[model samples]
Target chain A: MAARAARFNQQVLIDTTPLPDSIPKVKEIGATSAPLLSAAFFIGARCKPYNDDYMMCKTEANGRGELECMKEGRRVTRCAASVIADVNTHCLSEFRKHWMCLENWNQQLWQCRRFERDLNKCVFENLKLEKVIPGAPADEIPVHLRKRQIYAHSYANM
Target chain B: MPQDMPPVGGYEPIQYKRNLPARGFRPAYYLLAVAGIMTYGFYKYGKGVRELNELGREKMWSRIHLIPALQAEEDRDQVRRMLADKARERELLGAETKVYHSDRFVRPTFAVVPENTTD
Candidate 1:
């Protein structure tokens, strides 16, 4: 017998409505997965304050934060969007190369170290936004800087 | 035939050496070498696991930090759509109807209306 669903709702609704005039507007981020992963740390580095403020506002608003934290939310969105735009403008080639490598390599940073190094250098120099993993061990070299990635598919770096 | 047997010094005392080259350390030394290698390998493995753990932690924290900004973008989009749906509802039907029992951003079931059949 064929299965029929009655109680469970599996419907998805997509409403292409614009925000009302009462609310301010912000443009959503345009970059997809690979680029977003590659640029995440830099975005975190650049937007720490705004991000923290937004989170704090959300926490204070509790369940009501969705609508209440619009101001803080707008700041967070703008901060992230600005970081992405800046990177795209300043380090276009390096950014493209790194994200492309990431996309081809299952988004594994270890497999894309060479491109990542180049991208990091360019972003740091042009945007002054460093990619740092906060709370990483201070005594040892960061994973990104290691000469060999034990888990990489290719032995080229090793 | 002049008794060709027992020539000088009984046929040169019949040499018995096989000429095989001797090599390799004592068994105890070999054991020690294996132990040393294993110890170093285990140490390296532990170091690698720790590094991997730290990397994962760093990655998770990075994502957590980025969530606020990403969520803000998504929330804004949702808010825009909800507002748009509200406007559409008002245009199609002359008045807004209360559809929820409690207030917590319920995506209205009638938000996306299929083609109207009523003329």
Candidate 2:
């Protein structure tokens, strides 16, 4: 009887969503990625321009310890920093808080949870919608929200 | 073999130095070595921070511009596909590669059947 009830519950869950035929056609195209090399360059160059520049100096310029490359790297870093600054002006604290916690307590998701929540909230509120995750499960509330004690009980068992 | 020195035995008499022997390298060298190690450590730390920042920055920028840029690209590709489809449709309907100079812009001409070919 218990197994039959469980099977019936699963069937009910499956039937909750509408059929594909009934769903409206979406005109909007899904998001895509920036070119890999360009994206990687932007990221690497932005953070550590000197090192990146030094490498470029060695490879692209075919020289050793080129000061020009370092200068170019600095320029790139400055440009990236300027752009980042513009973005950061809106939610720097939130970004910092979230990123710092993530960096420090990487393996401890529970410890990082509040900071993540705060950051997500801040980003959504302050920045463009494009900056936010479109269909994040983090925002979802459980249908039968588990109590603190229930979480504690589970942790205790572990 | 000084007369005051104890005789050598299985347990040889230890010589006590009045003063410690001078180090092979100067104090300055040791200081420099320690400083070098510290500088290397700092360099490593800075590199790690930079890498971490890069990762974080990339993730954040992706959230902001990457999606929108990709969507715009997709939309453009879609439009191009639509145009291609229309061109194909026109071709099927036997529209000659008609050069209708309607405006300043010259429309792209598609492949047309030769007028002499009956088959």
Error of 1 at B21 (Å): 16
Error of 1 at A135 (Å): 0.9
**Least accurate 10 contiguous residues by lDDT in model 2 chain B:** B110-119
Tens digits of per-residue lDDT, candidate 2, A64-86, equal 32323434433443444443453
- Model number with the top DockQ: 1
lDDT of 1 at A65: 72
Query: What proportion of the true contacts does each candidate reproduce?
Result: 0.55, 0.00
Off by over 4 Å in 2: A1-11, A16-24, A27-158, B1-20, B65-119
Please state what fraction of the native interface contacts candidate 1 reproduces: 0.55
Q: Candidate 1, after superposition: displacement of residue B104 in Å? A: 6.3
Candidate 2 lDDT over B1-119, as tens digits, reads 65775456656656885777886899899999999999999998885564444445435544443322232333334434334444555768767343565643333454232222222
The reply for model 1, stretches above 4 Å from the true place, is A1-12, B1-27, B88-119
TM-score of chain A of 1: 0.89
DockQ for candidate 2, C-alpha atoms:
0.01
Listed models, DockQ each: 0.30, 0.01
